[model samples]
Target chain A: MLTTAPTAVGDDAALALWVLHELHYRGFAGVDDGLEWEPTLLQVRGLLEADLERRLRGRWTPPQGLSFVDDALEWIDGQDGVSLARHVHRDADRDQVLDLLRVRSLYHLKESDPVSWLVPRLGVPAKAALMELQFDEYGNGDPNRLHHHLFATGMAAAGLEPSYDAHVDVVPLEVLEQNNTLSLFGLHRRLRGAALGHLAAFEATSSLPSRRMAEGLKRLDLPPEIIAYYAEHVEADAVHEQLAVRTIAAALLDEEPDLEADLWFGAFTCLDLEDRFARRMLDRWGVGEVAA
Target chain B: MSEPGVAFEHPDVVLCPGGPMLLRGRHTVEDADGVPHETTRPVTAVCRCERSASFPWCDGTHKVLPPKLRPA
Candidate 1:
């Protein structure tokens, strides 16, 4: 049944994986939830996930010189990709920014849900630290303050649809791959290391990019509610990055050193997928990379 | 961390190498301008790199700074 489906890391493969993963998140309108557990579908999912994993790992070569933290930071510094946020900040037209926002809403609308799956899978220090980070992602018990809700509100304020998966059809292949990678890591017990690694890398990259996004939104004359979403991230992610890396990721690795490679895999995938997404968007816009 | 039951209590303040100082719990911090910034979240990252556009709080601009310029 899966013979015709592409098994590589390109658009067709990612699209198939995305659809399969979506069943586990919020099923398609006409699709039965039972299909989420159907053997044939699960088989395809496994194959696609394996392909994606192979593709992600193919790009990573373990750093030889620096400490893990320094290596990770240097990994990001060494990445040579277009900065979509910088372009948005300095030159994107209103339509382009809005298009990017629509694509981004695919993930922002469900922020932190994937990583929350790791809370129960962890031990003490990692568990507590992850919870501390998640508590903020969950809005400190205030529904209105929830990060995803914040994104929803921002989407509405910007005159875009805020419903979950509202922009899936409009999102590019890279976005699909990005979301798939996170969901894949979060769903597997064996991949817990990768999940937190992805979390740390994600939080590390978020704060500054969020600031650029906030400025870009402000420049576009978007509503304050929209700006507030990015504004909130600028602070939240700064705290979260430290919590994820120094506290959560470190604690996990200290207990299970065997998972170091997978941890690095997840982090590299996080940066790599984002770079692909940024490059795709910039190429589509025919915009050159802005100075970092 | 492998010691199972050993307590790993959250420190009130964590000095992240080359990054921010994470202050846990509540406190009011005075920035260079002498204005007080209240702790709104359960944990806050105070800008040690001093390049945060948010002033007292980190906005993550430290990542853009040269490694030598980042806080030790």
Candidate 2:
């Protein structure tokens, strides 16, 4: 099944890669659990990861004279990616919003699990800082407060399928690539810098946009659970961003220093992938073209 | 304040430069409206800029403000 599925390029390759990465996460039913490390499958995963990484690296140039760990929030704020949240805030109809929820459910259901891989691989201060942020992400030891579970609750309340990977088939190529990037950075010890960079970028960008999302849901009269999910992030991520950029990512940089470029690369990739996804969604919805 | 090499086990409260005050435990924060809000998480950021739409809790509006308008 791994070698034969028209896995050369585009959505086909993306889906194939996503399924391969899923082996490491929650494997599909009836699949051999040990296949997560099978040599041939590992080779295929490596080739696909290399391809994706090269493509991402080729598109990013580190921001001149800017320090990713120190200036992260401002650097990210300067980025002009198209906003799906803004569109949802003012323009999306009910059907379009529902479709977006389904697409977002791909990542929202899994939430912070990708970065959890870095826990065992980090040094003391960075590890402690990451857990400080991640503990909140995981609902501070309360399962009901867990972010992903919160998303699942909202999904079910919105009358959408709430199970993990339930919307994978409906997701566009950009969405798959976005998921794959997180997995790629998270699972590689060599890319721990990138992983935290990605985490910092993700948290820094979340707070305001989350408020927009909550407002949008309110305007649409969507389920209260769904609105609450976004509302939760508005405050949660404000705290998390400070922890991620200043405490977590900065601590890692203090120890290594050489990973700075890759850290910026990772941060840039996060913004770049989200931009691609947002543009694709907005264009599909006929919202308007996002400037390049 | 302790000497140069000092580090506390865990600083329960931190003032983030140009940002919010991070409180690491639960506390009742009374907003300008005099309504009290109890924190439910391990850490909470109390808005310092007085510009947050969320009021007592930061919604990160401080970051969007001019540097002069931001909290110290």
Candidate 3:
């Protein structure tokens, strides 16, 4: 019997969606794999996804006439929000940084896998451009250099459990929502524009903040592995940002001009979610104005 | 396998306005200091702004530069 939204609404919705999404990624060891396609479970998932999309759409107001693909970087830059990277760079203490890492492991452990789902779904030009960026993200077929593996190695070196989802229990609502948004965009072919838009925003913003993260890790004298992970992103994301905005998103726009609004919506959602996450963390830490 | 009027494609390179030069395929690039760095990825963005902390390889410093100061 399909009941009202599976009784997992409100505060638990994000986590529920995350768990259900995980079934498509890597299901739990004891859980039946078939549950992933269960019509009842999917019905619940549909309700949650619809609710999430509605709420996200409500928060977003489309920007004035402009080209999203070309202006993505500038658009992202115009949004002045709290930056967790800046806080991490100069102020966060060891325990607080550790807490941040624990929450971060929820996403960093998987890295680009969510977006990988879009490979077969994109048009040729967009597909080629995305693969160009994703090739680097996956470390150009070198498993040792694979981004997620790098994060796992760093986590292990830092004395944190490196296993996938090891820190899921400690994650905040902001973290869950942030992650669920990516999976939501990735899993649905209808939201492919949003997925790439999210990718563009993420890459465009990553490089400088990655430098800050590397410096912060250095300041704390944490394990070199962890520092190296952030250092890698400083250069990697620089290249990726270009490929994402100029090539990938641009190509996608050429193929599907109608998706421009969703592209902007996705970019806005990425920045907005990050801002909320930063505010929540700073609030928890009682930190004032982040270092300039 | 030659087509009548088609030209053979070579390795790709793209120059982003006010940004880095995107290079596809592996090659050795000498930095301003004349240090040779081997390309390690399928695609690489070489610094054009000369402001990148990791010179010869862009670390996105161009984005922070003023529009007039950005790479042409």
User: After superposing candidate 1, which stretches have Cα over 4 Å from the reference?
Assistant: A1-9, B1-5
The residue-level lDDT of candidate 2 at B14 comes to: 82
| Angstrom error at residue A247, model 3 | 1.0
Which stretches of model 3 miss by more than 4 angstroms?
A: A1-7, B1-11
Query: Which ranges in model 2 have alpha carbons more than 4 Å from their true place?
Result: A1-7, A290-292, B1-9
- lDDT of model 2, residue A105: 87
Better of 1 and 3 by lDDT: 3
lDDT (0 to 1) per candidate: 0.85, 0.88, 0.87
Candidate 2 vs candidate 3, TM-score winner: 3
Measured on C-alpha atoms, candidate 2 has an lDDT of 0.88
The DockQ scores of all candidates, in the order shown, are 0.69, 0.50, 0.49
Ranking by lDDT: 2, 3, 1
Alpha carbon deviation, residue B72, candidate 3 (Å): 2.0
TM-score of chain B of each: 0.87, 0.83, 0.81
Rank by DockQ (best first): 1, 2, 3
DockQ agreement of candidate 2 with the native complex? 0.50
What fraction of the real A-B contacts shows up in model 2?
A: 0.73
